[model samples]
Target: MVPPTTGPTHHLGKSEIEYYAMLAKTEVQHYSGTNIELGTACGKYFRVCTLSITDPGDSDIIRSLESA
Candidate 1:
């Protein structure tokens, strides 16, 4: 599962999604793209500041990200 976050909310230290993810010790992947780009990649018609990839499936997404 991937959960979205807003830029302002995160910067203001009021992002509940980020807080919960930290508590759960989950890895947070920061997309080096704008909110609109992130949203587009996720197939959403909105903005996305941040996102957590809970499951990477059978792909080498994690490895590729690390490499990048």
Candidate 2:
């Protein structure tokens, strides 16, 4: 989860730590949008530096992203 401006290092240190931890556990997908954009997509009101898609449910997001 690399932001556009800050690259992999966002201002919030916890985000970076979570990113590494998530990376070690599973496949991490790179979001091309900024943190703000990601937050909007997730229906949040703030920046989201990292998002964990634990269960995609019925969505085709996993397949689409993997194909891309």
Candidate 3:
């Protein structure tokens, strides 16, 4: 599905959906109004959303920090 912001492609797999559901306490929304509302809800209630961005992952970053 297409979202308003199209700068990057977000690859959400089944595992990611389950994970996000656990974090958000709600499933993802598709419709614009509801999607925006969910975003607004997240903004208001949750301190953060722990969604991952970037391929090859950031495990190296954490490893570097620990070594320092």
Q: What is the C-alpha local distance difference test score of candidate 3?
A: 0.38
Best TM-score among the predictions, by candidate number: 2
Q: Give the best candidate by lDDT.
A: 1
lDDT of 3 by residue, 14-43 (tens): 456556566866533232234345356435
Question: Model 2, residue 55: displacement in angstroms?
Answer: 1.0
Question: Compared with the true structure, what per-residue lDDT tens digits does model 1 show for residues 1-68?
Answer: 33445454456554565666788876555566678877887789987676667677886767777797
Report how far off residue 8 is in candidate 1 (Å). Answer: 4.0
Report the lDDT tens digits of candidate 2 across residue range 1-68.
22223244455765665567677765656677777887887789988777667677997777777687
For model 3, name the residue pairs that clash.
none
As for TM-score, the candidate ahead, 2 or 3, is 2
Q: What TM-score would every model get versus the actual structure?
A: 0.56, 0.59, 0.22
For every model in order, what is the number of clashing pairs? Answer: 0, 0, 0
Error of 3 at 42 (Å): 26
lDDT of 2 at 23: 77
Runs in model 3 lying further than 4 Å from the true structure: 1-12, 27-68
lDDT value for model 2? 0.64
